[model samples]
Target: MKNRVEILAPAGSYEVFLAVMNAGADAVYLAGNMFGARAYAGNLNNEELIKAIEYCKFHNKKMYLTVNTLLKNNEINNELYDYLLPLYNSGLDGVIVQDYGVMKFIHESFPDMEIHASTQMTITDSGYADFLRKYNVTRIVPARELGLEEIRDIHDRTGMEIECFVHGALCYCYSGLCLMSSFIGGRSGNRGRCAQTCRLDFNYNGRESKILSLKDLCTLDILPEIIEAGVFSLKIEGRMKSAEYAAGVTSIYRKYVDMYLNKGKETYKVDKKDRNRLLMLFDRGGQTDGYYMRHNGREMIADNTKISKDLGEKKQYEEYIHRTFVEANPKIKINGIVTIKKNNPVTMSLSFGNIAITIDGPTCETALNRAVSREDVDKQLRKMGQTMFELDTLDIRMEDNIFIPLKSLNELRRTAVDRLTDAYLEASKRNNSHRFLPCAAHKESRNKGISVHVLTYEQADEAVKHNIQRMVIDTEVMSGDEISRCVELCRKNNVKSYIGLPRVDRGTYNVKSNSDGYMIRNMSQKTKCDKEVIADYCIYAFNNYAVSALEDYGITGITYPLELNEKELSEMDIDNGELVVYGRIPLMITANCIDKTSGNCHKGSTLFSMLRDRKNALLPVLTCCKFCYNIIYNSVPVYLFDKLDRIRIQPEYYGIIFTTENATEVADVFKCFNNRTKPEDNTFTRGHFTRGVE
Candidate 1:
């Protein structure tokens, strides 16, 4: 049989785990008390973990543990390794991870353990997913930013086992690459303990918050398409949820997948009753299909409710009680009466076995019998003090008579509390690691690297002064005086600037020129040609004409607009120059800003996002805190620091830019870049546009 869409469910508690398993989940993912991203859930402890594992195994179900948090340098040392050793030994199927350091550590130290790349890694394309193959990752959870075609393409091209989130909350930023949550709060998403401050009702500039709250992703109708795409797993997001929710959602998805596979596409309809049942269970901001279909943002729905808030109140009560009694235990029979003697007047006879324990008033106390344990017996008698009393064992107690107070028993309650506290504390200790590894720095830039679309003269001067080897001038930004000043600056500072010369108007560079005498005769097609030619022209303009344009303007090295692979540059004539290394990859080109995409800006409609994955995360759009545009498919910012040698496609200008709300980190980037020498080019100079003595 073909690989069916495997239904993956989340289990935050032992009961939820059982519910999902019984509801027919193919596999269930859960987190322990600590190092789990959801800090607010009734997570399992180590003992419970063992039980969960054994139960799943006994039932022929698979259980995946979540280690999907970003780690700091100190967090990855002997302590973490020690904790992980047992988990690895416990026959865990795989671990979901995001950070490269974590990936490298797992790859080298525990090659036997299966590593599934977390969606936080933001793997958007097949190329990116292919990059993880070297690490022998068993599967990849692609970024949610990808469209259906993109997902299918990545699945087909890489042939790696792919998992996608079919339901649950959607993040505003790309998974794994987000830093908003970490930036705003000390709790790191990568460490599996995220303080979802994102969901708060934060207001900015008197408007509703836009950083943490986001619509949930729901893809009930697209099961067949997802199955057709050959994704290995369909994951549901809700580690912290009720058993009812787990059963309802899991059963619904399970029923639908079976229907589609058995009877073919369009053979089944999701029962309306099941849909309503799901709605009553839990939902945040309603639901959305997200970016699977198109780039539009309005597809998300919002149906905010008090379900989570109500459930939270219940959780607090559970924590204090230490035990959840679904129903009162109807065992352990005892009936007794006590007599109280005092100087004043108090005597009482009580029979707890048959009474509800309430009396109209306190009367003279009588005892059922002389207490075997006097201290325990007196404790009950003291309340009825100061009068004569008679005592008896019971009014009519039989040997097998059953008795239990509707009220709680102190001895039983105390025992349960101690048990719970022990469990919670031990689990806490097992997961807590106070430190992380020392922060590692990225590789050094060869020369000052490339700058593009600079908005000011100071930006130009800084690039030139720093040896920013190449600069790219957007066609609209290029001016005669500006170009002249830039050319002069490059000469003085030993830098190079590439100006965007309009290809349509320029001779051989512009594809649209019909004039044979003009340089356009050498071009393959006009400006409005096919996309392949457009791409080709963009590449060629950066590699050839842009360089000449810079040289003509008294500059030497020019930069390019498009990020290119070595193969693309090799096909075209290009000189050595730096390309954008570390930073967010710009995805969609837009004429308007994202403010217009803000939906329902009323008091209750503000949206925020969190790096819902296990890592540095933030709501990207409204907050712009750690927003990455290319998150539609999970992927990280471009990291070309690894391959500085083969980069060539220089446009009229080129530069490397690092943007962060934190200034110290930004400054640190320049310092770190200056310290390391490139393996490809030892002769390269730092902070320089071009290598030379002015």
Candidate 2:
């Protein structure tokens, strides 16, 4: 069972969920309406989600909810937590998280909640996987663009479970990081409602229209190769597909996986019969193996209609029957008067406005009902039965004038089957079942403190009152008296403080081993006595240099963003240092409001349209900070809280960060972290002074 290759499928709805599961999906991945990457699909609503979870557990299958959408500073709200808590508490196996902010919040809410880093994180290296392990992430879904070798390397180096996309659609940009949909359509893909604008044909002057539409990824041929590579799960990427499509895809993959495992990998092939069956279900253009085979991007597009096939001939009577039904009068019925005879034999009296006749016979019952005028009666008779008694008869026997419509009785039978199938299908997936541990609400931490850019006294006072234990003061405003005052105030309020200093002498800011605490800034600006001044204020900082060198200089903590490339961070020996677990990735450096020179409005705010091979994002100036400009594009928020296991960070040296404006949102993030931490552990601790050797 441990070596079993899991066939993961997409469950856009309960029906699709069941079809894929019954059709042979080992697991099903779905999303709630919010924060899911596939926004446009018929994704499960909350009530449906509850049923889906029950259904998965009943089938002994794993269900991974896709919380893998990028978040803005404003979108992280109390309502988000309201939805998250119940799911986590309900013995939900795992959450597929994309953004760091969501990861931070989930980690802070359910510290023990199993998290899988979504491919959206674009983690492409073993180092990245190793780095993510610190957050206790169960799996790392590597970027879709990775080769089989790359996936294996990551698997070998880091023992964390690795999931890879086996089949379905492929993205032109890197998975989980593409901004093309949001940039063009204002429909953010990270939110699960992506407008697939890439498939459209466009023209770039003089050239015949260029079809940027990509071929769907069908890796049936390489099933064994991927499984042999030690991939934990073989995921199919189609959250917004029809039930039939999900069934077809899942069935094909299931058959192939069985073939590869039971038979041999050489036995598997994508032949004409299977291809036709797949295309008959549905397709965008056609299918391809995609980047699973290493190649330049040129072959991404292939022959579009090569997959089409002739549908062959229909039955001779099919057309006539279909046309007759299509054009028939639907609102016609015949009424008859009823009578009964001796020996329990049923008789009918027909009186249609002064025309009366007596029909009495057990065998005559069939003939009498058919004598009433309706051309479509034969069709109804064929479906229901040969005789009136067999037609679910309701005997309204009377000596006088009561009229009963035979068509009306026939209509009842027809409606019953429709309702029965509809009801059964709906009822099939629901479960009021209970588990060993039902999900419950856990209180998240509310630790908000100083990340003030200006580092003013007013902001510092607010922090002191709010039990904000940490302050990171800028080196530009570094004063011994101000630092001492802040340190004493922190002590009085039972808070810890750190003065920020530039990394110069040994890539760290020096703090005295005596009073308060210190943070090391990685910014490349240092004066002659920058380290000297920091030491005078009892400040120590961790930066991009040797940890041993910083240890000698009494550097207390390291300040690094969650945006560190995993390979780059793995090369360093940061045995005991703090890392930024959560924050928005400031991915660009721009001249201040260069595009918004016109004072009237930011009407013509231009962004990076296209840069080299990478697509450009509209870097709108979301906010104006005193020193640095906070520009927001459709840039994804980063969450490393779930990746604590891969990163191997000492809890004391790990921290989650939010800008002053968005600090409150991290309340749930810290709450989840604090609840999971040991009573004596300071890993849930934050701020400049908390990163001391413990």
Tens digit per residue, CA lDDT, model 2, 152-262? 887887887889998788765555544445444545455565677555544322222223456778777777888888797999888777766776778778887887777
Residues 457-506, candidate 1: write the lDDT tens digits.
Answer: 54555545454654443222234566567656665765544443332221
The best candidate in terms of lDDT: 2
Q: So what's the TM-score on candidate 1?
A: 0.53
Clashes of 2: 37
Each candidate structure's TM-score, on Cα atoms with residue i matched to residue i, is 0.53, 0.48
Worst 10 residues of 2 by lDDT: 533-542
- Which residues of candidate 1, in runs, are more than 4 Å off? 197-212, 301-458, 461-492, 495-593, 599-694
lDDT of each: 0.48, 0.51
lDDT of 1: 0.48
